[model samples]
Target: MIIRREHAGDRPEILAVVKAAFPEPVEAKLLRELFASREYIPELSLVAESDRGEILGHVITTRGWIGAEKSLGLGPIAVQPEYQNQGVGSALMNATIEQANKMGESTLVLLGSTDYYPRFGFVPADSMGITSPDPSWGSHFMALPLAAHKPGLHGQFKYSEPFNAL
Candidate 1:
């Protein structure tokens, strides 16, 4: 399998993979909204494709803010149920992180599994002075500072508008 940027044609398959990966429909709905959102960063939306051309997983990062400063919010990453534990999700994540760094992004934040994300260098956002929009998120709210990260980036993290709508 290989990781690559998502294309417009991949939407349907991507949504299928996301829906199959999670029990709730909220994530799939969010993904649809993100695609049309102004905050959408095409380069940061990626897919993991099987050798046979099946989309095995998907991930997206959108424009977010830390106080008034620009940042990124990652979410709704999903690997097909059959693809779980096979590194498809990890590949998509590494590709997104690498691409974001190339774009000079400061940090990538997400609310995710404490066990799964730390391997990619993510830590509690509060540890870096970045507060979550929902304080109850606590440690599940994490951040991974990129190569362009700066010490001054701190304050309430506001996700893209669609996220606010949710």
Candidate 2:
């Protein structure tokens, strides 16, 4: 399988993959809103495709902020059900992280499973003095410092408006 940046033509298939990956339509709906928002960072949206050109997974990172410091927000990572344990999601995630590093993003935050994201260097946001807008997220809110760690970076983390609506 090949991991690459998502292209315009991949939208419909991406949507299908996302929708099929989750039990609810919420994630798919959030993806659509995110793509249309100014916070969307095209370079950080990626797909895992098979040799036959079928997209197997998708991941995206968008503009976010930790107080005044800019950050990246990762979310809605989805893999087609058949491809879940086949490493498609991992490939897409690795590609997104690599691209974010190359683009000079200092950090990335996400609301996800602690068990799943720790391998990617994510830790509880509270560890860095960062709090999520939604209080209920608690420990599920994670952050990873991509560049050199900044001890001074601490504050409320804000995702794009579309996320608030979700």
Candidate 3:
């Protein structure tokens, strides 16, 4: 398998992978909306491909904010159904995190499975004094301080418009 930056031509395949990974069209639609939005970080949208050139997974991180400080929002990570549980999602995540840290990003937030994201060092957003706009998420809304934790990093987290639309 190969992990690499997604290209313009990968859109269709990425959409298909996302749709296959989830049971509904919501995530797939969100992916398309995000791509057209200013929040979309082209370099941060990554894809995992098989040796045979099939896209097997996708992940994206977009502009977000923790109070007035700029942060990243990670989400909609998806793996092809056939590739699920084979490390495709993990590889995409590891690569995305490494790239984000290299870009000097200070933090990342997401709404996801606590059981899954904790392995990547994500903790409850509230633990960092960050609150999701959606109150019902509770512990499922998580945050990870990519760099050293800062005093000003706490507050309401704002995701991109595409996420807000959901």
Q: Pick the candidate with the highest lDDT.
A: 1
Measured over all alpha carbons after superposition, the RMSD of each candidate to the real structure, in angstroms, is: 0.6, 1.0, 1.0
For candidate 1, the C-alpha RMSD (Å) to the true structure equals: 0.6
lDDT (Cα, tens digit) per residue for candidate 3, span 82-141: 779988888988898898888988888999998899998999999889999999999999
Q: How many backbone clashes does candidate 2 have?
A: 0
TM-scores of the candidates are 0.98, 0.96, 0.97
Local distance difference test, candidate 2: 0.89
Q: Which tens-of-lDDT digit does each residue in 56-137 have in candidate 2?
A: 9999888999888888899889999987887777777788878888998888899998788888888999998989888899
Off by over 4 Å in 3: none
Model 2 residue 141 CA deviation (Å) reads: 0.5
Tens digits of per-residue lDDT for model 1 on 28-116?
99999999999999899999988999999999999999998999999989999987998888898899999999999999999999999
lDDT of candidate 2 at residue 19, scale 0 to 100: 92
